[model samples]
Target: MGRLATLAALHGVATVHSPGPDVAVPVPDETVVAVLAALGVDASTDEAVQDALTRAESAAASRLLPPTVVVWTTPDPGTSGAVLPPALPRALADLPPGTGLRVETERGDTVEWPSLDAPPTDAAAPGPVSAAPEGRSWPDLPLGVHRLAAVAADGRTAGAVLVVAPREVPQPPPRTHGFLVQLYSLLSTRSWGMGDLGDLAELATWSGRELGAGFVQINPLHAAVPGDPTDPSPYRPSSRRFPDPVHLRVEAVPEYAYVTGQGIALLDGLLERAAGLRAAVLDKGALIDRDAVWQLKREALEIVREVPLGPGRRAAYHHFLAEQGQALEDHATWCALAEVHGSEWRAWPSGLRDPRSAETGRARHELIDRVDFHSWLAWLTDEQLAAAGRAARDAGMAVGIVHDLAVGVHPDGADAWAQRDAFAEGMSVGAPPDAFNANGQDWGLPPWRPDVLAASGFAPYRGLLRGLLTHAGALRIDHVMGLFRLWWVPAGADPTRGTYVRYDAEAMLAVLVLEAYRAGAVVIGEDLGTVEPGVREELHRRGVLGTSVLWFERDWEGTGRPLAPESWREDCVATATTHDLPSTAARLTGEHVELRHRLGLLGRPLAEEQREESAEVADWLGTLTRLGLLPADGGDEEEQIRAVYRFLLRTPARMVGVWLPDAVGDRRPQNLPGTWDQYPNWRLPVADAEGRPMTLEELAASPRLHGLMSVLRPSVVN
Candidate 1:
């Protein structure tokens, strides 16, 4: 089909092309179809032409949709730029009345000012700009503090203004200190081979009271996608909204003790297995067996559910049900669907694919009881998490418990199934090419569509924050830059082909601050990697703390030496290492590189890279020695750890995180990225440098661990 004819046909427009006329006349679809029949072309049989036209029209329409508005505010004459307030609302509304706006361009220093009313045709098309309403004062405006303004009719201020500032909502107070820890499935005594809520509470209480730790930051406890052998990594979760019930301490339930005759006997073996699992980790130094623990607990919980919930407990359950309501239903529906549809909803029956379809509705009703059970599990998990937080508070921890928010949820999981509209289909969230991973990594998680998110007022994001912040004194946002933009790898494309899609950072941050402020929780952004310039500045401006990892700290512009503690950014939570990284002992001893090479997963040969990397580390150690920070030779591991903390103490960072593994001199990292089955990702227990398991009790008394804390005690203690 001809271009004009195809475009017209696709758009449902009729086109008339006369031999004598150069111009083609466009007519409506009805008219064209009737005329085509009269001409005997049988346009109804022209499906190819019709499809082409449809696509062409769609492309054209997309181009015509409103462009994003980019407002630029001129700096006050003498100043380089306006020193906007931390907040933006108040300043945007106070522009003087009857202000005339103009766009300026420079042609070799001769400035050309284009009229706002009659914008240049060749110039960038003018986007829709809403003028300031009459009689609104800048201070009284709801835009907060920092806002853009221009000179008006009296040369004071006029034209469009862009507001760049912190959210109006109050920010959560900083977490003064924290002891970062990870719970292994095999470590807790009461767990069915998995660390349970009871253990979490116990650990929090002990760490808070005896160790004088202000906060306890745990790994992500998000529910995993259910399967025979579930994915062990907590970072890859099914749902960020709900906690996994597998972490529940079965014996801790009030009704467990009240089980009748046969039930009690049946539960005995499960209880024994639970105790044995805990012993294995605490005594035997074995890695946590998550699948085995789940098997034991699932059996135990099935029996426990038979012991009827008492009236008061049932009422409390109902209250939780009420609080969770739709979200619970959706999550449970997702779980049930996964069981029937096999995880990925895309491969499911056509009728059952859309979550809102009648097939899904009927299935939801049919599986109502199953859904209730899942919801109950979530409630139990929440109760335990709250109890852990309370234990920290009761034990007198300053900042109490801090929770980790994973970067994203699994694509075929609850959040994706529940809020599909908010997520971008056929796109995966990933990282761009970086020094560590030459080939960028695709996380296989769907990203939130910026347009959809803003239109919904970020309700899904807000809800998640509120839920997580409920029992947390501080929240660590994994890959916090996701709030601003996400790297979107289109389906079937490599990570390199991915582009950065922008998000309403201001809106997202505002919502986050609002929820965190109300929950009285501090926010920490894991702003690591190839961050866009000014993102950290924006986060700092918003009272959000940045993450400072010791290994990554460097003099970016100078000779590449490890950044000095005094020169480190103050607006951050400084840490020796994270869950995904090598533990301090492992790094100091060079075990991590060796482990990678042994698995045949190292990008380069182990010995060669080790030599180069070790030399850098040796140089860093020399620098530390020169600065009087490193201890003299022949010191034990404990002394070495103390030296590391002493260096961290020198930084002006508001908070310092003492990794639990580091305290115990654990030689292995809890997780090693880029290697899945080759190594256990999240199943390792807290062990000593020699791979000897350490119980909470032993950890408390270990002089090596204790000495390290002693160094940090004065710096973190209130």
Candidate 2:
């Protein structure tokens, strides 16, 4: 076995070696190491072993359990119900020795402290309950969120008051709503190889005013690690706390007009190239060239950095620096380091790889200029995002822009490297084996250690949320269940060997709610898999919206039937599809399954199942016809699209999402899962159902597209 594996096995056993109340002391090192390794720790090294022991100790110390007993006074069991003064403290303190005490009451309840030995019967005669003790009033829980009902002393009746422990609540931002769109699928005439922010603004203006969309929800715009065939999945971001500047509309940069001084020629050329690139995507209907865009932007930014910040701009820059502080510094530092060390920090020089070592500090000072450039890029990206949100609002979007929060960042990237102490080393976040993916999938993103996060008051998580939510009217959290618990795949183990690690859902939720409340943003959880029981209920109670996708909306527990529109959950944002899956047209026509088959992604041969599935869909269409939901033959395609919207209108969902591509009959999905090379994944342009490229103008004028909009107008207005 490798040295690290050997050490990890030893550490695992040693860490779990706690002598039970009746067992012997000093468990074997081998046993402990085995247990520690199972938890994804390499305990071979002395340091690793020590770390495991410390973690175990910390977990034990922080473990919370329900109170042993809860007691309160009320009318005598058999007598006429009468108002009574209860001896609250005595009843709590007099519990059997070793029993934990929890005393709860309604607002304005009194606690008269006699001795701990005093009985409730010894208190004064029944009277109105005294005012609540000073500094003891229950904290104001989130309004409009659900709370679990408290049980009274009789066990047969509900308590008069409800006290909820702080938890994450997904509350909609105050009086705001907007349309949601997939950015790449909303191609414009001006886009280089794909859609840009300029197109986004126009779409927002049109949708907000014409369609009355409250918000414009978009996929995650998180920075991707720079490389060839750059990771197309936005969910695997280099850093969740920073936006990718590649999304910036080059012409939108203020500095673009001021290029004339030293290094100005270089920037001018790059800008010209960027403009050409945009022209190609918009004019020719080509695939998005992310690497090309990044190359051009990087060169332009290099020159822009040379232009000294004007006094006023300098002040703004300083303000941004102050706001970002260490987080920005760390992210920029990681970027600089990546230039020299590549994406995997572990492969770098030992001294430089350790984020806290003196060697890294020296490297930071040496690469100070590069770091500043990266920081500037982040600041500019932030400004544009805020501008987009403002534009949406100015155009009368009620909810403005809703941004997506990726579930995690790349393990070897900025956030993980910068916040190593906060993450569980050698462990990766993933899903447990399920029907969809029997082998399970490891995300290769490190997970936060619950104890460590709690100890630090969730500062890292809070900072990330604050950055994403700063200008967002609403935020969608990918894989929201991770807030409660995450399946941890230990490094070097098959995904099946991994186990679920619990988190303090209350604390995590509290932090999320607090941040969202501060940012005036609503929260939505992408809860779409093998969710534990009560998770959806808890999310609904917290006012956090859940995601209800058209394809998966089925009554799995009963006779398996696609969920009726009216039966959809009200506390959710209903959408036709998402970035990770095939678009609506593709699903309806079986293009996705065909593509998967072509890519050899099917577990079974496609020939056998494809025919059967196709027939099933035909039958489904027949049902739609029976329900009067199908369009008449020979009408506009938009008429058929309108039928789809009419179905959504039947649902009671508070918010509805319109995939940008669907509005224009774009056949290609923004992404295609399980294919890294055969498909462009995130690079496809918005195209029509016939696979014809459509520019922004053509999209606007398309009869099929406009017809769909006509159908949605009445429902949105109502």
Candidate 3:
């Protein structure tokens, strides 16, 4: 290998990739240097490259252990049911034969494995890792993150984070179907202009019990960046770790009932305004105004804060305060500071930018009341989420509320500010150039540094998982491929100048599996679009279900025809549409093309785009007609939409998701990719085929939705 190639390989940065079959793209030298720089390696100058290369070459020899190690115990084939021992990974095994090994387990128990017998650990992250011992090498260890230290015969010492995880994640209970709704767009009469937690709970209860649905998956409700006009996209969240307070239903808070005297008059006025906001959207045909909704809710929340908490509520609040610990404090502090300084932490006074600096400490204390208010908002939202889950359970749903986890956090969000050390400074996660877009794409969210995560024992990742799974029946990871690797683009550079940086997929999956196992929640990975070879298989092997959109599930290796229902993978959340794509109704009628054309997002002539889109839709419809899933005589838009979902039910997929809007014959895509101000992306309320907004109650009573649900599995009633 070349010097730069060797350095890049050692750092888990890809030097070459095949964006297409038999075509290799060698990463640019500048890209490699920039990526290495982001990882804290100085390789700008030739002399610096040589020096860095020399250090990297000797890193394995000088290192006693990697920052982290994994002990994935498998069942012994020879012994039938016995589990194989957790061997010392290749790195530890390759140590001097007489080295002593000590482990401190998560439970605080200590174990001293005989140094002579333990298998080696991952080989110091040198060139590549080898397979672990599957035979009778060591004793079976508990599944948890532990601490391991090694001392060699010559007094050399090293320590590593030891992670023991289940071989797979929790599996789904059985075949079931659910609805996938973008939370903001599913407004109800009671909603304050847009969908709130109250609407979510009502939808869950009605669908789960009345429709016999097993789950209801919603888009990310992660804390959004506070701005005069906030970014409407939930995927670009400020903090994926905390739920956004704007989703909270003000009237549902227990304390909302206790306001007395003049407080009642003020709250009544706020409620009247909130009703006007809701009416403007549902009756006046105005777009959902998230900022206005939040303003009203925020004002009412400030009023509600005056009521003193009872003893039980106070204790519960204290428990939540203590459980969240410093993470909550940092997030609340950042929010408090944002109110004073501005939303961008980077532009704040230098010392204040450092979350742990003395200046930030004093500021936190001075603004303790505001900090407490933000923290309280988080607590209230969390409580409502838990209540929603309870409502689902009460409705006899098997998989209650399935939640989505966004790929990463916004750079200026609380997570990036609070956990600054764990993210790359000048790098953003994106995709490399491909057939879809020659320019490639840059998602302005910062990725977590694999090196920092390993050294910190993946504390931040674990905390994130725990928070999300606290009330989720299942967790759908958006852009699941990010668990394995991410395309990192340097600031001010085209995405074509980016390269894929590998993460420790094994460790990442292990942590994920461990957390899901603890929560007893199934995981569904969004593995749509171009996937790297073997990634889907690996995710499946770990019991992480893949996403299969009907439009894209063709027999690519053979005839390139729509895949037969029987041939679809059983472990997936099968669906006809997603929030990013055209709704089934739109796809069937070709309105999606017209919508794109209207926004000037079409790359070709209008007629050409329409022709291609219509052909694709006709191809799917023809397949459906051939298989007798759809009427041989052309059916209407509603029948075609039903047939699309009916085809999903034919597949052995464990869970099928029905986009909520499709149930009511909605043609507008919740989000149209590749457009900004030109389109009303993520701002429209769920409406009917006629383009009229529908309240949650109206949606529930829609005969069209009932007719469509009848086409689903027999579990759901007509």
Candidate 4:
């Protein structure tokens, strides 16, 4: 057991800390063994454990540095463009004197110290580190990823990727308020069954110009895994690298006007069908059918693809293809193959499962045309996303469009199949047992292997950030704590048996900050829920804004009372509700409890659940009444909703987000966490208090919405 423990520690696998503090229950030996196996270490038996431990220690001794080294440049004060000399990083400092070194900087410069006399000081910089130097003080190497080669005294040599980044991410210009919404739930009259990029553009334009919004934060639009019944949750997507084509507005395509003969007839037919599909959800109360909508759009797109691109358009397409490179090819190939085999790539033939295998290469040649079609879809989505961002900025938005980045990718999706080496096999990402659920949770998404990530200098992760930030003003990371650690559950095992696995948070943050920096984008960390104590502080120090939902912002350590607006953290986005929770109306009227009870999702007696929920609401209402945001009479139900936004304004938070559904007195949550088909998880359109879906035009003209927006002044202290 001791030998196994040492082996696990060397691999950064947690054998404890699941189910949390004060609990003496240790992680099972089997769980530790399974996690080790996933990391390519074998500790199945006592003899195996000792053997693995010996090999691990031997590797540690021989290794000069981790696969990656990150450094933050320290600028000297009271000097003209001067930087302090960097002290020896712990990794370099530990080596014997007279070691040889070579550095190839990003700016095509080189620095070599043959039989080093001195290039490093004895002191090291303090920050998130993996044997990082005490203080980053390299005057010669500018900010970028560089290469380093080291030769030890005894003739051993090692090479590592060196990263130089800024100390913090870009900060918001000033305090600003924005609308938070799930893009698909917001439908305009022109949309075909679900919201499209066109709808997003109009929403941003209207909100930025008329409603005085500074940003429009929307749910992730990452490409979905295609199947008969595609998963509707945007959080679980096929590839975070590409936007989903389902959200594209067909008519917006320039080639739509160029279509002739049979193509024009087919498009018209699809358009009429699309109108019927949209009417079903808005006028007939039917849930949003993502698969059906995709089918119609896919058919229409096939016809549009026949039209030849203009000279200028052709050039732009080639530019996009060149920039996207191999990543686009892999994603498109997966999509084309999925059309033949299925969405789940693991179920495909063994030869085809390996993306780089010779068989897969042969298959790619045969499916060349289909692959090109899918690649075109990605390009179209990219074009619309850029248009949406431009619309927001043109309408005089301050922060413009804010895009969400989900924590992980679907287990059997494009990213997992294409980048299998970077992801753990037979291990799924999840949460340890907490107050919410004793059994914990398995999200069914594969976690990126930290070993692979460091070895490659987090190249894949950096690429993902750049893609998302390309058209975003700000990027919000879902479950930002994941930058530090994630719970790993073995396949087919209970989530409760999972244990936490640590990542080099220093390297992760350096890559994130560097990429976002290059894009000139703000960063928001979704650090809600029971967070590890120092995680939020570290993020804040890096200029990453945290998410502060109203319901969860309490003085937990003290009286457990609602945290006063004045007391709220300034470096956060404050809001009354989010997609995962009840709308303002539902909380005020206790309709959420009723909805859950009706769906048989209640875990307790009806009266007991209602009483607990009611008490919680009463406490918050009392706080609001005292703050003068709520009137003593509280006459109209919608007035209470308006009052909630007013309260959010009182907080000194730099960014304020109003959940778009709450603007119209919506009574239902866009998502109900625990329920799947029993409740429509992500299908409902934005609706009014009576549960009637409202179109974008109606919503814009809604009296309830206007009244809510009126309370959202630029800076309302009181």
Candidate 5:
């Protein structure tokens, strides 16, 4: 390895291998240097590399502690397996004997330990090097993000974040089945052309109470960047912290009821348009047009805003403003400014580019009304989110409303603009060229700069998680491997030229565990593909459930055959399909291959793709038959679907997810990963096998949906 690579690795800016152990793919020197540059380290030359390496080593040696320390909570006092306090690392081992230690906990209480020389009983060094007396331990700390500071015997002082996390996050209540839907695609009769939070609440309540579902996991509902033709994909959102009010049910707002005069007339006109838009999708079989829906909702919301908030509602809005604080202000300011300038902050005039500039401050002052309007929208969005949660819980769901968190935010989105300092400039998060995407993918989303995140004690990450977990019974982290490392593709470069940028996994997981612990929520990590060797084990240790898809549960190293139900991992939310892949029905009938061919998305020859896809399906069918999951003569597609779910139930997985569309034999995928414009990605409504849109009422009345639900329910199935 070159000195530049050495420097990058030392600074946690490089990876030694691809995600899998089979490939020891070294990051190129140029990619390492570019990634280092993004981290503010100029390692462009040999001299620069040497200088950076020396500085990095010197800095590490000089620090009394790392920027952050994560300590696992001790579960029981009498247990031999109780977690030990974090040991002082080699960097701080040379501190003088009488170095004093103190901790200020999250609950505003202070605790002091005597000195490094006088450690408590039962202290054991976590590593080979022992500093204090053997079997010594630090003072007990309550679970939280505490402040830790050490005053050396020579009077030198240094501080670090002290994170106390539970050994593992709380497990799921039981092995229960739930519906999984794309919130926007699951439109109801009352929706304003597109599904909203009100529809989400209704889905949760009806599915949970009537169907006995334990949870409803939905796609990320993060804010979208407004535009003439807005991007409909929920995965690439403008802000992950605050939800989009475009998903809000306008009539649910209390002020909506009090609108008068011209406002009522304006809303009436918008409603008429909304009715047409809704009809276009439901009756005419047209795809859901998000921008059209948003346009009508925006006009209607303007009229609703004119109706002044009642005293109680006004107080609640102010409370939300105070709670969200500066983050919300920055987001609101960006939204307001986007109305005058554009959504892309970089294209704004130099004076307005910097959010904290004096000119920007002046502009914000002038646009205070618009800013307040955006803030009010955020408050309204939050209210509906809380209502959905309440609806889920009241409907008797265990882990109600499992919200999905996208890997990163859009390049020109509110989060990138608001938290500019935290994002690496001129770089995007993506994947290395793997078996799936030969050319690899550049997601075009900026990654959080690890150094900057550490400098801020991971406040940005903490806040993001906290916001998502606030209204979620569980949070599903998409591409959860990102918590350890991210592929950083330099600007204007192909994804193949990107290198892995390592993050402090310990600290990242610690923050996640801490937040989820506080929220009393379960966490599911989407560790589905190309994960490094230890990533899944670490996530499992921390009580984050893994995502296991039925199609991919094969023993690759051994038989390459479909894994038996008993062989499947227990710590997962097992499902037959995901948004990115084909629906179960499509997979069974090989319609996914036909769909790809129709869209010109097939990478190989049509016959080859069809044959290979057919063989894969047949293999799974053979397994089902051998295991007696299928009837002797082999059942129809719907029966096979039920058998596939039965195989899932036979596994020890804690949760089973039923793709809502699968209940009615929806064959089309909500998203096709490879093609953007080639397919109507993210625009399809929940439809049956023949691609007919199905409303909630229709779905409720469908015997097909009820039969599928019965398969999940043991009592009805028996």
Candidate 6:
């Protein structure tokens, strides 16, 4: 066990702190062994541990450079006119004397590093520690993903990925306020029962141009795993790489314009059904049935597909196919196969289990039409996403269409099947036991294999980011700590038994910065809960903004009171509440406590929970009053909500996000974290104060919403 721990630590496979910093928590031996096994290391016994450790040490010693190297130029604004020194990697010190080094930049440029003095050629001797060539300085290279190659004097060749990134991501142009929404919960008159990319475009344009807002941040649009009863939570998606076709605005498809006669009659029937689906949620108080909506859209899409694409559109689609390449094919093929067999690939016939098997290939070939249909769906979805971005930009948004990225992929989803070798087998991404939940959490998503990711030079990660960034002016990464480390739970194990598995944070951040730079998008990390000590600092250093919710901003280490607005960090998106938490009205009215009690989700006595929640609200209200942002006599519900925005506006935070529901006093949380079937997790439409479902048009006209928006307006705030 001790040997395993030692080797685990050596391989960066274990962390002392999973979510806390006060006590040193060692990962259980069982967890360490399991995680090590996932990394392709055998550590089940003493003999195996010793053998693995020896091989690991030998491999580390023999390697002149790591599989990937990240170089970030520290931007010093003070040195305005002076040229700064190039950042150098310390691994250069480990290179053998007289070893030749070559750097191939992404732009087809190359730089050479001449060899230093030769040393002894003793095979058993340790790696050379000679200094770098004294007179030579690193070449000023363009920021991008590059390649590095090293040739030893003995003719042994080694290669690594060289990533040159900006020290920080570009920040938003100015302090601006925006709307934050669970996109699925936003229903419009034109939507097919639920919010689609069309709704996003309309909301972005109206909010940005008409309301003078700066951006519209929405939930993850990632693809969902298909099932009889599909999981509706955006956070647990099938693939983080592709947007869901269900969100496609069917009417916006170019082919929809050409549908005629019987096809048009068929579409009318589907549209009527869609109207009922939308009415069921808005008027009848029925849950949003994604499956029902998709059934209708699927039929309508088939008719639309029959209309041939014009030459221009055909060329554009062919270009998209060429660009997306094999990733699209694999994803489309998986979807096609899922329709025939089942969504869960694990339960499929043994011959079809492997994505690359002959049987799977044959199935893909036989179902080529279905595969092409799915592929077309993805391309249409992509076009709508791009159109949404264009709408936001045209509406004068500073940061338009800020998209959220899910943390991981579902175990039986497309990415898991296509990139089978890149995910850890039989392990789920989760959280360690923390103060909030003694049992912790298991997200049921497979984490990427760090070793495999490094071996592949993080191509999957880079590709996913590229896809999302294509139509995003800013990207929010959910549970951003996963980039540094994630809790790996053995399938079906208690979350307490899970342990932290470290990732190559340098490489991860470098890839993120490089992509964000190329896309000209801002990056925001959801760095809210149980963050490690230095993670926030590291993110800030790289120009990534952190999330800061008002309720969680109290000084825990000090006065246990509301933190002063002036003390809040500037590199954050400050908000009064998030989608997962209670709305401002619910908190102020103590309605959240009642709701939790009604749902039997209260962790303690209802009275005690109410008292604690009430006291917290009082503390913040007092702070707001002292700041002269609220009336001393205690304001009305709408006034208090506006006061909360005023408090956030006073902060130095670069961006302020107004939860769309909060504007209209929606009290229910969009998500109740611990319970699945116990609550309607992601089925509710955006509602008004009285829990009345609202359409985009109605929300725009709502007096309460407009009242709240007035408080956040730059003219009023300034």
Residues forming the 10-long window of minimal summed lDDT in candidate 6: 119-128
> Candidate 2 residues 1-718, lDDT tens each?
4443344333222212111234323433453344355445657667875666567556544333221112222223243222232333332322232222122322223333222232212132332333223211122122211212222233321111122222344455333334556576566655545566777777777777766677888889888887666786788988899988877776676766666765676766765776687667666666778888787767777766666778888899889999999999999999999998788887899987778799999999999988888888888888788788888889877677889998888887888888988887777888756768877788888888765665554678878988998988889999999988777777777665566666767556755775675576788999998787778887776679989887678777796666777788888888778878777777667787888887888888887768866775565455455567785452244555556666666778878777767876667766676667778777776777777767767866676666666655654332
Q: Give the top-scoring candidate (TM-score).
A: 3
Model 6's TM-score against the true structure: 0.95
lDDT (CA) for every model shown? Answer: 0.69, 0.67, 0.87, 0.86, 0.86, 0.86
In candidate 2, position 251 carries an lDDT of 65
The CA lDDT at 571 in model 3 is 96
lDDT of 4 at 242: 96
Maximum-lDDT candidate: 3
Query: Which of 2 and 5 is ahead in TM-score?
Result: 5
Pairs clashing within candidate 4: 89-133, 124-134, 124-135, 125-133, 125-134, 125-135
List the candidates' TM-scores in order: 0.78, 0.79, 0.95, 0.94, 0.95, 0.95
Cα lDDT tens digits for candidate 1, 284-314? 7666878788878878777888888889999
**C-alpha-based local distance difference test score of model 5:** 0.86
RMSD of 1: 12.7
Clashes of 5: 3
Candidate 1 stretches with Cα past 4 Å from truth are 1-175, 279-286, 714-718
lDDT of 3 by residue, 1-718 (tens): 7888888888999989888999999999999898898898888887898899899878767788888887666534343122544454676567776777777777666766546545433221211122346332454556778888888888888899888777887787679888999988988888999998999899989988788889999999999999889999999998999999999999999999999999899999999999999898888989888899899999999999999999999999999999999999999999999999988899999999999999999999999999999999999999999999999989888888999999999999899999999999999999987878878899998989889999989999999999999999999999999999999999999888899999999889989988887787999999976689999999989999999999989999999888999999999999998999988888888889898888888899999998988888888999999989899986988888888988998899999999999998888988888888877889998989989999999999998998899877554556
Q: Where's the lowest-lDDT run of ten residues in candidate 1?
A: 137-146
